[model samples]
Target: MEYVPVWIAIGLVIGVVGKLAMPGRDPGGFIVTILLGIAGALLAGFACRAADIGGDGGLAIHGAAAVGAAVLLILYRLVMWSRTR
Candidate 1:
């Protein structure tokens, strides 16, 4: 799709922001980071849609995505931590 590249770029930026917010050694590499970001956006988008919040390219949607990314990052850390325990 035409939006794939734009999504990836946004994802990468969101992913980097998530990583920065939760500073530590990443268990996975770049691809995982990118996936996390993309997934975060998707999660937020869906939730917003369900809540009747349209994505009007505003700060609210972006902020939700960031929070989603941070949440996923935390979950990822917990999973990896449990596996190593």
Candidate 2:
């Protein structure tokens, strides 16, 4: 519901940051970026829940999400690079 827009905004921010953090050519475009961001956040959330690390909201969660997004982007690049060789 109301959280949808908030999630999208978070996703956009995470996506842009992920791109800037790992500058260079990659796959897909804006849509893919958004999806990556959202997926990363979701992944972080699930990990945190499984680990019982933190509550539903906190700086740690947000930081983890950002890191997760960057990691995903980096992995994607690595895979693509390997595939080309």
- Top-lDDT candidate index: 1
lDDT tens per residue, model 2, 1-85: 3333444456568887776776666666666776888777667656765686656556676666667766776677688778877
Clashing pairs in 2: none
Model 1: colliding residue pairs: none
Off by over 4 Å in 1: 1-8, 18-27, 54-57
lDDT of 1 by residue, 10-71 (tens): 66687877667666666786668768887866676557656867445456755665677667
C-alpha root-mean-square deviation, each candidate: 3.3, 3.0
- What TM-score fits each model? 0.67, 0.69
Q: What stretches of model 2 exceed 4 Å from their correct place?
A: 1-8, 20-25
lDDT of 2 at 40: 71
**lDDT for each candidate structure:** 0.67, 0.66
TM-score of 2: 0.69
